[model samples]
Target: MTKDIEQRLKNKDINPTAMRLLVLDFLMQQNAAISLTDLEKGMGPSDRITLYRTLKTFEEKGLVHHIDDGTGTTKYALCMEECDADHHHDLHVHFYCQQCKETFCLPNTQIPEITLPKKFRSEEMNLVIKGVCDQCNPD
Candidate 1:
């Protein structure tokens, strides 16, 4: 499992240090995006600064993408295989479950292209749908 995680980091051009491997392993086990605080809590006894740096490196390498679901806290999740340091093909809709307060990446739901004004340039795009998720929906 550790070897697999190391290979994934290397694929993204990220150095697979001990801490990086540990961080990536933890991220892989998560079913939903997680905030820095949540990651720190889950890592138990880990240095907050080190964890934050690891996450930042992953983001820069396109190994992960951070989501701003309007919850005032940034959450992170793994990026698709097509993502790289130069470009991130993560223009997919994110879902925020109100009941569980968890954010998930709906990778299959691609965001439609929008025509902007001639002088307008788009750098990044994010769309978050807030509602009850399948797990939280009683019906």
Candidate 2:
């Protein structure tokens, strides 16, 4: 598992330092997108600044992508393998469960291409749907 984590980091051209390795491994185990505060809690005694920097580096390297689910806090999730430093291909819809307060990546649902006005340019795009998740409904 450690080797796999290291390889993932290397594939993104990120150095697999001890802190990075631990952060990536932890992210891999998550079932939902996580906020920096939640990550700090989960890491247990790790420096918040280091973790934030690690997350920022991962985002820049395309190893992860941050989402704003309208909760006023950014959440991070692992990007698909096709993502790289130059481009991110995980342009999928995100779901935020109101009941559980968890955010999820809906990779199977791709965002449709939008044709903007001639002078306009798009830097980034995000769509979030808020509802109760399956675990919270279970009916």
Whole-model Cα lDDT of every candidate shown, in order: 0.95, 0.97
Per residue, candidate 1 scores C-alpha lDDT tens digits across 1-139 of 8889999998988889998998899999999999999999999999999999999999999999999999999999999999999899989999999999999999999999999999999999999999999999999
State how far residue 106 of model 1 sits from its true place (Å): 0.3
RMSD of each: 0.7, 0.7
Q: Estimate each model's TM-score.
A: 0.98, 0.98
Could you tell me which residue pairs clash in candidate 1? none
Among these predictions, the greatest lDDT belongs to: 2
Model 1, residue 118: displacement in angstroms? 1.4
Candidate 2 lDDT, 1-139, residue by residue in tens: 8999999999999999999999999999999999999999999999999999999999999999999999999999999999999999999999999999999999999988999999999999999999999899989
RMSD score of candidate 1 (Å) = 0.7
